[model samples]
Target chain A: MSLKVENLSFSYGPRKALDDLSFALAPGSFTALLGPNGAGKSTLFSLLTRLFTAPKGQITIAGHDLGQAPLKALAALGVVFQQPTLDLDLTTRRNLLYYAALHGLRGPAARGLADEALATLSLTDRADTPARNLSGGQRRRVELARALIHRPAVLLLDEPSVGLDAASRRAITDHAHRLADRGTTVLWATHLTDEVGPTDRCLILHRGRLLADAPAGQIAEGTTLTDRFLALTAETA
Target chain B: MTPDPLHLSPNIPQGGPGGGARPPGPAAGRYLTALGAILHRELARFLGQKSRLVAALVRPLVWLLVFAAGFRAALGLSITPPYQTYITYETYILPGLLGMICLFNGMQSSLSLVYDREMGSMRLLLTAPLPRGWLLFAKLLAGTLISLLQCLVFLGIGYAWGIRPPLAGLLAVIPALLLTGLMLGALGLLLSSLIRQLENFAGVMNFVIFPMFFLSSALYPLWKMAEASPALARACALNPFTQAVELIRFSLYLTPNWPALGWTCLATAIFAAAALYGYDPARGFTRAKG
Candidate 1:
């Protein structure tokens, strides 16, 4: 497993956020974490990325224990936060280069990686343009490009498509899928069921507990994934 | 069971910061890189809004040129370390004006953190692969760099107005500015992580900033406060801003106040630690919805 989380638990004071959650993803697999609002997806992402440490469980990224060897584990993971992370005043290329530098990529290597990542996102033409001038989709793509500049083995995105238009959302998801296809383990957190296909692995979470983890095809046997999701969460409610 | 058909490529091992070919020491190099990125972003943001630079400069300039003019006679200036003889009130308050610039910039940086949280960019920053402490420190360093630039510009303007410090004093002022900048920047980081909403920040500025500036030894000497009220003098002496102001005032005269430096360093450490704790995922302020 490229990413392994076991018995993960977290809380915000009195309210438990993630409850004994355990999951694992192969080196080159895409997993969708499906849940409604307040289902602890964000908290889970925070724990996985080591934004906060969980004393109750363990998280290992690319064979490195997150708690013990945070830098190594973090170095193996790339994260796309729900918020737009790019500096709006900087050109897209500059933003990527900045992120690249953070991971110790400098000189020609950093420039080359920034260029390649921008090209991968079809944003090479917009490299010189400030991020603020880009459309919502373009900006999000630029963020994705920045995340990939380090070429991390594990990519964790927290609700990457929230405010994006349908076409843009589709493009972002497709791009993620392509990245996963190329061996980057991806944990995509979202509530939209349509974004997950039947063949994809899916985990349903509700009120900070894992309700089910199965193939999307099996979970949504007869009805739509959305319908099944609503039914499952409603049953627990 | 059917095989999971979606095959991603093999995990490509890429060199990360302080990893690969880089020799490891204290990880300062990695932190410097992160700090560089954050500083670049901050500078870009400050420069992008053409109004911000003007506003930052204009506020202190008005206080120096106009407000100081009105009070020049009412406030009698004595020979101070930075002042040779009986100087105008305007000249005496130049360091205070510089302090004010740093104070405002620090608070403004905090305000923007709240704005960033609301806008979602903060989330991106928080989730970066680096340690949260390093991230927050990077932010502090960035804010300090900007504040330092503003102080330099303000000093240049002061020179234009015929308020000249010792030529050697300019060299000494850099370290002073850096210390003041870090202290204020740390306070700003603490506020940024603590204050969840932009609306509530105004209350902070009203209650904390105004009092800190007005009651501090910024506009007047501690001895002056003592003449008015011993209690007020004590308060001014204890105020961290007073320490910052004193540090700058002495350094601008090429003098070092060891006590002031100690106080500023202590305050900076406390504030920076609090900010880090506030952003800590375990027990910090991130749990509350921004």
Candidate 2:
């Protein structure tokens, strides 16, 4: 398993966020976590990335228990948060190098990985440009490039394309799918149905609960994913 | 398209990363790299914001030129342990101003922490494989470095303005300045953990910086405060910042105040521990609602 979350629970004061959420993903699979606004998607991502500790459960990344050994567990993971995390004043290459260093990749080796990630995103020419100079789509691509610089076994992105145009959104989604194809377990969280593919596994989270876990085609029954999602969420409501 | 067939682990030599495909516990090398990266980014950010440098220098410069000059006739100085003769008011307040610079710069760093949290960059940092305490230390060190550079420049300008410390005292003051800066910076770090929003910082400044600066011997001597009020003077003597200022004042005169050093060191330790604890996810605040 690339990722395992067991009985993860979190609370923001009296309000419960994630309640006993448990799921596991195999290596080299693309999984979409579908949820509406305030469905605890961001909360789940935060726990996986270790931003907030889950008070009641265990998380293991590629055989490393997060609670027991955070460094090794975190070393095996990469994350792109729902918000833009780029330092706009720094060049794309500089940003990548900084992230690579944070993940323990540095010097010529860090440079090589950053270069390779840039090239993968067709951002080689844009590498020297400051992040502020890049378009929204290109900036998001740079974030993806930064996340992959460490070559993490599992990658988690929470709403990776929130403010991009249609084309940029498609490109970001395609790149995420490509990362999965290269054997990196990917957990993508978003509310949009168009982003989900028929063959990809789907985990439906609603109001801090995991309502369904199956492939996209199976979640929809005979209806479309959009309708099925609405029906299931409304029923729970 | 890719050089290494293994997607998770890129090829690294023995001394480098152990095995890319499930690299072992982040070794010493990785920890150093993480520290270096955070420092480099902080320095870059500091240099990029020209306005910040100006603001840092200007605040203390105003005190040295305006406030100190205005208070010169009103404040009298006697022969003190740190002073060989009666000194000018600007000279009297110079060390205090240095303390002010570090205090403000420390708070400035805390402000940046809040900004980073808002911008989501802090989240990215929290996710790094290294320990959170190390990351916070790197940040504090970076802020301390910036404050030291500004303090040096301010001291040079003070020398030009006819207020000078002994040439040998310059070298002696470095360790003092560094310790004071770390204590104040760590205090700021601790404050940042409690402040959840950016808008609330102005209140913190009014509630924290003003009181710390005013209650300490930054502008007036503890003896003077005692003359004004014994209770107020006792509070001033007890304040950690007063100890920091006294430490810097004596260091600038080539004197070592062991009690002041002890107090500042203890405060630094306590503030650093509190800041690290605040950033802890399990026990401290860092959790966000979905």
**Tens-place lDDT digits, model 2, residues B182-281:** 9999999999999988999998889999999999999999888999999999988989999999999999999889999999999999999999989987
Q: lDDT by residue for model 2 over A62-111, one digit each (tens)?
A: 88999899988888888888889999999999999988888888778778
Per-residue C-alpha lDDT of model 1 across residues A1-237, encoded as one tens digit per residue = 989999998877788888999989998789999999999998888778665678799999989998888878887778888877777777898888877767756678778878877777777789999888998777777877787777788888889987887666766777688778777888999999988889889999998899989989899988888889999999999
Native interface contact recovery, all models = 0.23, 0.46
Give me the displacement of residue B221 in model 1, in angstroms. 1.7
Kindly give the number of clashing pairs for every candidate.
4, 1
lDDT of each: 0.81, 0.86
TM-score of 1: 0.91
lDDT of 1: 0.81
- For each candidate, report its DockQ versus the true two-chain complex: 0.32, 0.41
lDDT of residue A151 for candidate 1: 76
Top candidate by lDDT: 2
Summing lDDT over every window of 10 consecutive residues in candidate 2 chain B, give the lowest-scoring window.
B10-19
